[model samples]
Target chain A: MNVLEIRGLSVDYLSAGGTVHAVDDVSLDLRRGEILGLAGESGSGKSTLAHAIGRLLRPPAMITAGSVVYHRKDEQVDVLKLAPKALRAFRWKELAVVFQSAMNSLNPVMAVGAQIDDVLRIHEPDMSRKARGERVVELLRRVGISADRRKSYPHELSGGMRQRAAIAIALALNPEVIVMDEPTTALDVVVQRDILHEIRTLKDEYGFAVIFITHDLSLLMEISDRIAIMYAGRVVETGTAKELHRSPRHPYTLGLLRSFPKLRGPREDLLGIPGTPPDLRDLPPGCAFHPRCQSAFDDCGRVSPRLLPGPHGEVACLLNENTGVEVQA
Target chain B: MRFLARRLGFYLLTAWAAVTLNFLIPRMMPGDPVDLLVARLKGNVDPAAIEAMKQAFGISDANLWVQYVDYLGNLFNGELGRSITFFPTEVTTIITGALPWTVGLVGVATLISYLLGTLLGVLAAWKRGSWLDGVLPVSTFMHAVPYFWVALALVFVFGVTLRWFPVSRAYGLDVVPAWDGPFVSSVLYHAALPAITIVIASMADRILGMRNVMVTTLGEDYVVMAEAKGLTSRRVMWAYAARNAILPNITSFALSLGFVVGGSVLTEIVFSYPGIGSMLLKAVENEDFPLMQGIFLVISLAVLVANFLADLAYVVLDPRTRQEA
Candidate 1:
């Protein structure tokens, strides 16, 4: 069953210059208990799409057109259509998110347990303080931090521990979907590996869908069940992680994969994408990626390709058609 | 606790610097205070009487180091000496008598203003780009307007034009000193104009300040995290945004507490309310060196002590600062 469905979602940021089409004509679905990696470069509107899922974007950024229908338990509610009161209840109990800079996300002044209890106090105020304390301890233990650390402040914990604490807070309500935006970006490689492992174990144990958004394609490939490649505010490709690794169809996707320094490979220089993603405010016409695409034909500059199915994965590249100029690299 | 001790030590050093400057600045001035006072009292006093007065005022032929040591010694024992203007009244006595009036008047006013300002700020931030945003520019302009000017305007409108309350003084002469309803009411009635002036004067800046802080904190990723966690907007505002935003204001408020002893000189002068500001002004005009030095010492100490408490409060309010220290 589809846990979350985003249909033709478009987000526009109303800046001083003009309306910036941050997320343009994006649509995707997350199945129950599946980890979907939403991969993109810095200006690709990946985080904007994630924020839109929860109706979290504020002006001058707005959801211009979209329907984010989120399914919690059995019933479904269009997140945008929900009234203020309904929306309040809908968060945490149904969906939770671990934001970027998870360490700073925790209040510096408040103790860890009190902060967690505050979550319960807001969402489930009827729970007695003692009961909440017990639950917090259990939650802390599950996240591999000492229960006593609950009395400590956010500053008291290391970066990795803080991330775990944030994850624990996200899971406190046991929501069906947990959206993580670069959760391990600040941690060391070993710590990042540990956090990813913990996340995999937690997802398996809790049985929740994950919309993991990150710029690290290799990290996404390791854990995601399926991957969606976003460029210039649109999803260019979507496939099983294994299929994306073995064979990438889109030019942008192939370039992104090749850019990463592979641990298993012989010593070789990394190939970074030649230019930055197109500016959303003054985006180029036709295919947004065409300017950056190496195998661009005349048609590629004139016609924008929608995400279409090809041999290995869904591809948005015009070159993937019967012309057969294999860019397997 | 060690951090608190460290802060206390730092404050003491600051106070020592302040007191040192206090002792030095008076001596640095061109005219001798004793000679000036003698010149003023030529008709009523003899040369021997002038010498005796100077001796009482600690202007004997002692070394600068000895005088400094005596000044420090006198401060510890609460021996602020007598005021020249308010003859034979010790500086300590005047300050103590005036302290309660300022506390009851400005302290309560400040409390009321802070609460009202913070609430308005929160609401204005939450309801951004509405009529409330229009209120911000106006309040910010009001905040920029000087405190004395605001007090004068309030007096003009409420006292001169309307004649609703007393123009000056804490209580009416007919009210008597019974602490009864009439006395209480009269004091409040007279206080109302100044209180309102002070509140209106401080509220705007605090509102704008808190609004800016709230807006910034509300945009923080944690606030979004809190919102995503099913917390209501009110919860997110108060629990997450307001809690963090109020830290700077809290420190500012703590520092303001020290100023309570000095009183707003212009506000007191306008109303002729016999507070520390009025007393300090007279001392400055008369060049009563000891009185001036004493008042400065008190003000600096109050500021230091309040700041110390503020540092302690940071630990209580923000656990992260506690860990870091």
Candidate 2:
């Protein structure tokens, strides 16, 4: 069963120039107890989509049209319809977020332990202070941080430790879904690997689903159960990690996969996708990726493609139109 | 500990410089205090008696270096010399008499303005583009008005038109200043207009400054993290954003507090309030060198002390600074 379902979600940023379609008509599902990797480059709207789902977007960015339904065992909640009071309760307890700069996300003035305790104080107000302190210790331990280090401020801890503390805070209430937006991006490779491994272990132990958003497709391939490739505010492809890795159906997905170097496979020159992501305010007429797509045909620039299911998963491209596969609406 | 010692050393150096400047400024002026005294007495006195009076007032012709040494020696001994305007009365006594009125009136008013302004600033920033933000222009306009103008306006409106508060003096003439309720109430009642003027004139800067700092602080990732933690809006604002935003305002408040001893000169003059500001103005007008030096000394020392306290506060409030020190 799907833990969170997003339908036709469109987020627009009302800037001085014009309305920038940051996240346009994107739909996807996060299944229970699974890691759904959202892979994209910078400015691909992956983070924007995550923020919109969590209702954390500030001014200039608004959810123009979307429906985020969080499915639970006994009830379903239309997340967009929640009142301010309910929204506060709904966040962290039902859906928590680990931001991109998780290292800097912890309050600098506050100790890590107190920050975790704060979450407990808000969500589980009935819990005694002693109990909250104990829970903080447990949460810290689960994230591979020593209890003694809890008194340290954010700057006192190393980059990796701060990220762990952030994860600990996210897990303070044991939310069913955790949306980690590039949680390990700022850390070194070794620390990133350790954090990713720790996250996978915790997910297995706690039975909570994760929507991991990052631009590193290789890291996602190593950890995610399923992967979705976002290009210029739209998911160009979605498939099982193994399937996407072995044979990516979308050209954009193939380009992303080729961008990263393989350790053991036949060595080839790294081929980065040409041109930058299109400006959201003034995108191309059709197929936002067509400007950079190498295999673009005559019709690719004139006709936009719907997400059609090919043999592997779903692909949004004119090339997949004649593949004799049913389109998944 | 070494950091604190270093900071103390810095303040001591600053105080020395300030005292030296205070001593030099009055001496640098063209006219002698004795000449002004003689001018006040007219040409009727004998030259010998005038010379005797000059020596008595410690304004006798001597080497500049010898006079400087005497000035420092008298300062160390806590003898501020005799005031030329109020002859035979020591400068210390005159200043001390007026010090309390200024400290009580301006000090309380400044503290009130800082607190109220900071609170409103946090609110305005937290709810940007709200009604509070809309009112900011009016506050800024009030702040831009001249201090004396505001004082006069308050006096005209509250004291003259409404006939509510006393337009002049620190207290009613009938009531002698005492620890008793009636005397204190009368003093406070008279101080109301002047206090309100100072608060109104000063509050705008605090509000605008704090709001600017808060608007920037609200964009910090930790504040967003706090909000994402599902903390209430109030906690996120006061505990997270305001806590950090208030650091800059504390320094400004300390500087303003230091100026409290100096008092609001224009406001005091307009109200005819017996504060240090009015006393200082009288000393300047009368060319009372000792009195002028004493008042400037008090203001400079207060400023130095306030800055030192602000440094100490920064060390306590910001862990980042603590680590650096």
Candidate 3:
């Protein structure tokens, strides 16, 4: 069942010069208890989309036209239309965001427990202070921190500990959806694996859909139920994580998977997608990805491929026409 | 605490150096201050009376080192010595009499100005491209206009033309010298022009300083975290951004406090206010060595102590400072 559905969303950033179409027309969904990994390079607007769903997008980054409908209890509610008080009430209780650079996200002055307690106080104002503290301690323990360390300031914790504290804060309200934006980007490989394991365990125990945005496709393959590849503010491809891993259709997706340095394989030199992404403001012709696509043609330059039905998945590529089976669906 | 003790020791040593310089600079001048005073007084001063006055003033030197030692010894005992210009009055009494006026006037005004400027600066930063940005340029213009010039203009408009407040002096001559409501009100009323002039001149730089800091701080990943957590704009503004932005402003406020005794010479002169600045001016005009030395010592000491307190305040203001500590 779809837990979060984003439709016809386009976010424009207002600057001194003019509006920057940061996120062009895009739509996607997150299934209940499923991890939807949205993969993209920097400036691909994946972060903007993630921020938009959480209603965390600040001024100058206007959500021009779209609906971010969150499904809870079989009822669809547009998040953008919520009043300030209603939005805040919904935010921590029903939706939480584990932002990028999670290590630095914890308040330096406040203790980990107090920060978690703050979320509880804001969201569950009815909870007694003592009860809130107990819950926070329990949350911290679940996230793998010693209960006593809850009183310690954020600086007392290591980078991994801080990330854990941030995650714990997000989990404080037991929200239906948790938006993890590069949550493990700042952690070491071993810690990243450990945190991801903890998250998987937490998801199993508590059950919240996650919209995970990251650059690491390999990492996404390990955890995400499905994956979406974004380029120049649009989803180029998306499918079940297993299907996308085995038979990726979009060249950019294939290129990205090939680019990952495999440790055990008899590897040819890792193939990197040549040329930088086209400037979003000055996108070349029709396809933003055409300049980087090795299999570009006149038609590729004239038309932007939608993420249409393909074999076992959705893929946006001009080459899909020649590959008839994937296109027929 | 040990580190703090070491810092305190170093500050005290530097302040001692200042006090020593305070004593020496005046005495080292080309002519004897006593001789100059006597010459100015011309035959009204007897040779015997002059000698007696010199001895009493601590200028009848046994030796340079001996005099220096005595000077330091006297300073330890709170003997700033009497001001020759304001004859028969101790320097300590004069400073005590003048300090409350300067502190009451400039201190309150500076506090209000700094707080107002910092708050406005934070507001401007939060709404970066709005009309609030326009405020800084006007404030900067006011700041750029010399303190004396602003003072003169205020005195001209408010003092000479409007007659809203007294043109000069802190209190009316008819009022008995007590900290009563009318006296206090009169002092505040008369001080309004100079206080405002100082506020206008200094507040812009403070606003600009805080605005720059706030703008930089707003970009920190933690602020993004706060925003992502759905904190209200005001909470994010005050609790997060303003808390960090106000640290530098607090230090600036402390420095302004340190210089409170020095007063703004131009503003003091413009209003003929009986603050230290005007007193120092008169001392300079008369070459009152002891008075100059005493005032300079007090000003320097105030500055050093204020800076020390500012450094201590850093731990409270910025968590980073405490975490590192």
For all predicted structures, in order, the TM-scores are 0.96, 0.95, 0.94
Residue A83, model 3: Cα distance from true site in angstroms: 1.8
User: Can you tell me which runs of candidate 3 are displaced by over 4 Å?
Assistant: A16-19, A263-268, A322-329, B42-46, B129-134
What lDDT score is found at residue B215 in candidate 3? 95
DockQ pick, better of 1 and 3: 1
Q: Of the pair 1 and 2, which is ahead by DockQ?
A: 1
The residue ranges of model 2 lying beyond 4 angstroms of the native Cα positions read: A323-329, B28-31, B39-52, B59-70
Order of candidate numbers by DockQ, starting with the best: 1, 2, 3
Candidate number of the best DockQ: 1
- Per-residue lDDT tens digits of candidate 1, residues A1-329? 89999999999999888889999989898999999999989989999999988878888888889899987666788998999889888888888888878767887777788878888888888999899999999999999999899998888889999999999998898988999988998899999999999999999999988999999998899999999999999999999999998888788888888788876757757776887788888877778998888878788777888777776568777776647677645
Per-chain TM-score of chain B, candidate 3?
A: 0.94
Report the error of model 2 at residue B218, Å. Answer: 2.1
For each candidate in the order shown, give its overall lDDT on alpha carbons.
0.85, 0.88, 0.82
Return the top candidate by lDDT: 2
Give the range where candidate 1 chain B is weakest over 10 consecutive residues by summed lDDT: B316-325
